[model samples]
Target: MSTEAKRPPVPSPSPSPAAAQKRKEKGTPGDNGADAARATELAPTTPGVRRELLHSMLLQRRFEERCAEAYALGKIGGFCHLYIGQEAISTGVMSMIRPDDYVITAYRDHGQALARGVNPRSVMAELFGRQDGCSGGKGGSMHIFDAKTNFLGGHGIVGGHVPIAAGVGFAIKYRRGNQVCVCFFGEAAVNIGAFHEALNLASLWDLPVIFIIENNRYGMGTAISRSTANEDVLVRAKGYRMDGESVDGQDVFAVRECMARAVERARKGKRPTLIEMRTYRFMGHSMSDAVSGTYRTKDELEENMKRDPILLLHNRIFEAGELTEGEMHKLDDEAKAIAQDAWDFADASPEPPLEKLYADVYADTSS
Candidate 1:
C-alpha cells in the first residue's frame, strides 16, 4: 500500500477529532437563461470583486490545463489530481477568508494553494519536483504546503486531513484567535470512517472549521452513488447537530457568500459548518485516466462544459456591461503569461540536492 493510504489516524489537538463534508446536487446542470440568472444572483458585487475572482479562476484553469499537457509528457510524478472544473469553489472560498485564516485540503489542491496566494512559479516548480518547490521537491503534486500562507498541506490521504483541520481550529480557539480553517476534500471521502469521527468532534467542540466537499460528481473513477447511500452528503451533518448547506460550486459568488457566512460563524464561536459544492470535473480523475473508462460519458462531459464556470462568470459580467470582452481577453492573456513563466521557471530550476534528503524526514530530536 502507498504511504498515503497508511496515514495512521493520529490524535488531533481537539478534545476529539474534527471533520465535515458537502456536495451541491441540484441545479439545471446547464448554462442557459435560468442558470445565468442564478449565477447573477449569487455573484459577489463589490469594487473589483468580479474581476479579481475571474483572474483567480483563470490562473488556476490555465495552470492546470498546462499541467495536463505536462503530465502527458511525464513531467509530474506520483498521483497528480487536477482541480480543473472545480475552480470556483477554491477561488471564492479562499477570497472570503482573512490572511490569518487557515486552509487544509486533500490532494486536488493546486487551485486552493494558488487562490491563497502561493506564486504560480512555486506551484509549478513543486509539480516539477524542483528544489525551489513549495515542499522543497520532497512533495510533488499531492503535497504542496506553504506555512507563510497557512495552507496547511496538500495531503495525499483521502479523509486524513479532515481531523487535522479540526485540530487547527481547536488551536485557534485555544489561542482565542478568530480564525477559520477550511478543509477541502472529494465526495468519496464522506465514506471514510475518519470523516464522521472528525465532523462529530468539530461539532462537539465548536471548532471553527468549514468542511467543504468539492463534489465533482465522480469520486475518482467511481460515481458518488456507487459508494455513498446518501446522495445529499450534507445530511451527514445532521448526526453531528451542525448546520449544513449545498451551494452552486460553479458560481463563484454563490460560493463566496456561503464561505463568508461560515467564516463569520467560525471566527465568532468556532462552530463548524458542512457545505457541499455541486460541481463537475472536466477532466478525468487524473492525467493517467483522462477518460474515466466506462464510468462517465462524452455527452455528459459536453453538457457540463456548457456551464463552464470560467465562461459562465465571464459571459455574465460581459452581458451586464460590468466588463467588456476586451478586458476579459486581457485577463485571460495575463493568466496564460503567468502560466508560461511558471513552466519556464520549473524547467530551469534544479533538483533537490542529496544532502537534504533526510533534512525534514524525521521529527526533531532537540529538547
Candidate 2:
C-alpha cells in the first residue's frame, strides 16, 4: 500500500522540549538545531549506513532461518515464531530510535529484540531454555526480555502488552523524559480491547508512543481480510484522533522514512501515531504451523516470497551503488556465522536449575 495518503504533518527536527529549555536557559543554540535538522532529514542514507542496514536485515534473516532449523531439530521448543520475511520493519524502525527509548512487541519478536540490540546469544539461549538466556530460559520464545536495553518483552498474550506500553509512555511523560515507546503487534491484536484502550489513552494523554501494526496478511490460520471488518487497519487510528499512515514493510528505506517522521512527531510532543506495515511472513505463524497451510495456498506464499524484504533491500543497495552482489554474499555469510555462533553458545549453555524455577517469580514486596 502507498504511504501517500492521510499523512501527518512532519514536524521539523527540532530539539526535544527538555533540550530546547536547557539551551534557552544556557542562552545558546546547543549543538545548533538547524544543522541537526539537516542531518535528520533522512537524506538518502549514506552508503556505509545503507550497508549496515542491509547487514542487520541479513543477520535477522539468517538468525531466524537458523531458529527454524533449531526448532526442527528440537533444540528450540515451545511456541517459536519466526520473523522470516518481516525483517525490514524491525531494522528500519530500530534504526530511527535512541538507546534510551522503549520497545515492546508481540510473540513474533526475535527480529525486534535483535534490532533493539539484545544480544543474539542470550536470545538463542532463551529459545534453548538455558539458564543464561535473556529471560532466564523460563519465558521461552514468546517472552524474550532485556531490561538493560529497555526492550520490555516479547509478550505472549495477544494485545496484552499494549497497555503496558502505554504505561511506559506515561512514565516517560511523567518523568519529563524525551523517550518514545514503539509498540508492535500483529494485525489481529487491533481487534482486541486492550489495543483500542491503549491507543485511546496514548492519544488522550499525549503519550509519546508509536503503535505499529505488522499486517502480515494472516492472524494464525485466518486471513486478516476475513478476521477484521475493514482490511485497512489504518482507519482505526482516526477514531482515537491519532495520526495514521501505511507503509510498504518490504522496503527498508520506506519503513525508515515513515518511522523517522513518526519519531520526529513523538519527540516534538505530538503524541501517538498508528502505522500499518503491509508485509508478509514466509513461514507459518509458529514452527508448528505449515508454511503453506490450508488457509493459504502454496502459490500465495511463493508470490509473497518474491518481495522478500531482505532481497528487496539487497537489490536496492546494489542498484544504489552501496554494495555489490559479491559483498552482499559475504555479509550473508558473516550473518550465518553469527547465527551459528549463537546456536553453539546456546547449545553449550546449561539449562535452568530446579532452584531457578522459584527465582523472579515474586518480588520482595516487604521492603
Candidate 3:
C-alpha cells in the first residue's frame, strides 16, 4: 500500500493458528495456484466477453465523469459519490454473477448498478431527482434501488447494510436456493459491529454470501492506515472462520478471477468469503471534497492515477490482440455517447410529482 511520505507504515495483525495453517495449505490469496486456474473456468475468456467487460468499465467512467459535470451545474443534488477508479472491481465481479443473484452496495454504487444491468438513463434520472429514476427520484444518488434487476439498493449509512445482506443470504438458504448474495462496502465498514456480526452469522449459518470490501484506502477523508490498526483487512475473516482473499482491484481480470472463486464457493457449498479489494478512488469521498481535500497530497494522487483501471485493461487487451487500438477508441466513443444520452434523458425528465412522496413509503397492510 502506497502512503504519504509523512505517514508511518501500518502494521498487520498476525493470523490465528488455524488461519495460518489454512494459508499454508492453500497458499496466499494472490498466488496463481490451482484455485486461481479453476476460477478461469467459472467465467468465459472469449474475446467477446473481454470486449463487454472493457465497454462496461468505460461506460461507468464516462457516466461518472458526466455526473461530476452535472453536479457542478446543479443538475444533481444530495451526497453524490463517483466510482471513478474502482470501475474494474464492479465490472469484473458482476460479469461472473448470474442475473438471479443479489447485489447490494454502499453509496458509491453507480458503477455496480450499471454493471448489474441497471439502465444508465434511469440512474442519471435518479441523480437528477426525476420521476423516471430507478428509485422514482426520491432516493437521489445515495439510494439507487431497482428491484427488477435484483439490485437491493445502495444504503446511505456506513456499515448499516451489512446485516441486511446477511438477511438476504438467510432468505436464500431458507428457501434451499443456490443463489448467492454479494455485499459491497468500504474498508472502513469493517470496523462497524454490524459488519462483524453479519460475517459471523453468515459463516455459522453457512449462508451463501460474498462480502467484498472495497478498500479504497480512505474512509471518506481519513486514510485506512490512520483509521484502523491493521491495513491488511483480509485477516478479519479468521475471526469468523470464513475463507478470505485479497485481489488487485485495478486489474479487471484479477478481480473477476477472485470473484469467480468466491461465487463458486457460495453457490456450490453455501459458503461465505470475505474479499478485500485494494483499490484507489481517483475522486473525493463525495462531490463536497473535490479531488480529495487536505488528507492526501496532489503528488500522491498523480502517482496512483498511473494505474487507472480502464487504461490498465485497455493496454492488456491491446497487447493480447483481442482488440485494436482504433476499436478501443471507438468503444470509448460509444461509451461517451451512451453517457451523453443518459444526461440528455435526465435533463428532459420531470421532477417527482407531489403525490409520489407518499407512494412507496407506506405499505398496504390491508391487502
- Return the top candidate by TM-score: 3
- Ranking of candidates on lDDT, top first: 3, 2, 1
Where is model 2 more than 4 Å wrong at Cα?
A: 1-43
lDDT of 1: 0.80
Model 1, position 252: C-alpha lDDT score: 77
Q: Give the count of colliding residue pairs in each prediction.
A: 9, 0, 0
lDDT on C-alpha atoms for all candidate structures: 0.80, 0.83, 0.84
lDDT for residue 348 in candidate 1, whole number 0-100: 89
**Clash number for model 2?**
0
Cα lDDT tens digits for candidate 1, 1-367: 2432322121111111111001122223433455545545544465387888888998898888778767766788777888877888999898888888899999998999999999889999999999889988888899989999998999988999999998998898899888889999998999998899999999999899999989887888888888889888999999899979898898777787787778777877568999999998887687667553478987888777656777656655564567665666788889889998999999889999999987987888988
Cα displacement (angstroms), candidate 2, residue 58, comes to 0.8
TM-score of 2: 0.88
lDDT of 2: 0.83
Off by over 4 Å in 3: 1-44
Q: Order of candidates by TM-score, top first?
A: 3, 1, 2
Cα RMSD (Å) between model 2 and the true structure? 12.2
Against the true structure, what is each candidate's TM-score?
0.88, 0.88, 0.89
Comparison by lDDT, 2 against 3, better one: 3
